[model samples]
Target: MEIIEKAPAKINLGLDALYKRQDGYHELEMIMASVDLADRLTFELLPKNEIVIETDSSFLPVDRRNHVYQAAELLKDTFQLTQGVKIYIEKRIPVAAGLAGGSSDCAAALRGLNRLWNLGLSLAELAELGSKIGSDVPYCIHGGTAFVTGRGEKIDFLPSMPQCWVVLVKPKMSVSTSSIFGSLSFNSIQHPDIRGLKQAIEADDYLLMTEKIGNALESVTIKRHPVVQQIKDRMMKYGADAALMSGSGPTVFALCEKKTRAQRIYNGLKGFCDEVYIVRTLK
Candidate 1:
């Protein structure tokens, strides 16, 4: 049997790190939403108990360390399934771009395997399993707009965000999430108005949403990679309603009210960046 899934990239509308926990994870409050840009996953059943991964991208590891393979193993162990599976990932989303490519791929694998193996796991159960894979995996398991807290494992469903064009730019460099967290000086950080952002979204106040847009990690990322700041500046100058770095360091996204303006910004940044995508908010 073959099962296909769409693994969409995620954008953090608001992300703040409150404190580092004893478990080596940080406490965070973030608002995440899916974008139209996605990676495709195709699963094929195997005769033996093995997890195989194939991807066009030469950069990503295909071994057991790969999140997709890990997801298959987790499901097999959890359910005691005898079947093996082969996963093919069409990698459109940039690797390590802070777009949750790996996490989404893992989520896709979990969802695909459930269908392929006749495991009637609920979405909540799948998300619970996903959390064991990665913090972002749980949210990606049930893709949509959400308010995430508690090391990004806890999710609260939010109303669909107002439709808009998102211009995403990924520079030719990858930033390590661990290094960013290690470099962060929590004392100097300014907390974003996460509550205000949530209320604005609830009320459908686009203007207030744009005004309140902020990420506490921006300063930490910008200091390390000035290109991120430059991207944000250029996007704002080119008429984005709000521009912020999505997750940790590199990939920056600009929210535009109009598609044409987003296209303009995308075209303008193409020369400066290796990867640039213009996509609509999935919600």
Candidate 2:
């Protein structure tokens, strides 16, 4: 039997870092939402006892270095499954674009394997397992909109934010997430209003949501890569209702309630950036 999963890319509507924890990870509060842009994964049973990954992307590893391979390995080890499986990734999301593409693929692998093996794991259980893979995996497993806290493991499901078209612009260069975090100076941090953003989504107030959208990491990333700021400025100039960096560094997404405005942003960005996409929230 074969199972397929759609791993949608996630965008951070709002992200704030409260402080560095004793464990050396930042205590974070964020509003995360899934976008229609996604990568597709196909899982097929293998006769031998091994996990194999195949993907169109030349840069991605098929070995344990890949998140999909890691997910399959974790499940195989935990469940002591004798059967093997092959996973083929139809990559759509850009690599290392701050879009949580890898994490989403990891989540998809976990979900797909559960069905393929008849493991009968609940989403909560899968999400619990996902924590071992990456911070974004849990939220990606539950996909939609959520208020995330505690370094991104804690998820509080929220009603879908007011629907809007999302225009994403990815710079050709990828920024290192670890490097971005390392350069963060707590004293200079400008925290985004994560709670207000959450509340705005809860109230279904699109205008307020646009106003509240911000990212604490934006300035840190902008300092290193000015192109990110340039993309944001262009997005707003093209008629986006609001614009913000999705996660850490490179990809910036703009929200527009109207399709025409979104199209304008998309059209404007096409010539400016090599990678641009216009999509909607997954809800």
Candidate 3:
């Protein structure tokens, strides 16, 4: 039987980098949520004892370097299974745009393969395995809203964010996450109020949530790509409750409480940017 999974794009409402860790990863606390924009994965059993990955996107690597391939291999080795599978990815999310598209896809692969092989693994189990793949994998495994910490392995499920329309604009350029983080000077970078952001979400206060929205990495990215800030500026000018660069972003998203305002932002940015999307947060 073929198993299908939806891999939604993640948006960070608040992200803070406290310091560089001993492991070379920045100590982080983030409030993350998924949007309706997603990639689809379809899994079918392959007769040969091997893993195969195919995607409609010309830009993605289909081999061992791909996270989905690593996820499948990890599961197979851990479970000692001979059964093989072919995974077809319907690519919808923009790559390297700070959306966690690859991590989400890898999570979907682990979830799908679990069912196709009847591993009977719980999401927690799947997430444990997923953590081995990437920082965002664990959160993607349990998609919704979450307070993530400790280089993204620790996840605290939070209440659903106050409902809003998200208008995303992806600039023509892609960003390297490592380079962005490498450029960070923790001494000077402003830390977002992770605790306050969490409280606002828990209280379901959208206004406070927006007021607290910040990313420690925004200045680092804006130095390299001014388009990110430009988009945020345009978003605010066109009527957005809050605008922030999500993750290590070339993609900036604006949150709006009203659809009409979101549409106006979308309309204004559609002509300026090649990839623009208006989507709601996934409840």
Cα TM-score per model: 0.98, 0.99, 0.99
User: Listing every candidate in turn, what is its Cα RMSD in Å to the true structure after a full C-alpha superposition?
Assistant: 0.9, 0.8, 0.7
TM-score of 1: 0.98
Worst lDDT 10-window in candidate 1: 204-213
Computed on alpha carbons, the lDDT of every model, listed in order, comes to 0.90, 0.93, 0.95
| Decreasing lDDT order of the candidates | 3, 2, 1
Tens-place lDDT digits, model 2, residues 176-270: 88788878899999988777888899999999999999999999999989999999999999999999998896999999999999999999999
Q: Write the per-residue lDDT of candidate 1 for residues 13-55, one digit (tens) a residue.
A: 8998999999999999999999999999999999988888998
Please give the TM-score that candidate 2 achieves against the real structure.
0.99
Clashing pairs in 1: none
lDDT of 3: 0.95
lDDT of 2: 0.93
lDDT of 3 by residue, 1-283 (tens): 8889999999999999988989899889999999999999999999999998999999899999999999999999998999989999999999999999999999999999999998999999999999999999999999899999998989999999999999999999999999999999967899888899999999999999999999999999999999898999999999999999999998999999999999999999999999999999998
Clashing pairs in 3: none
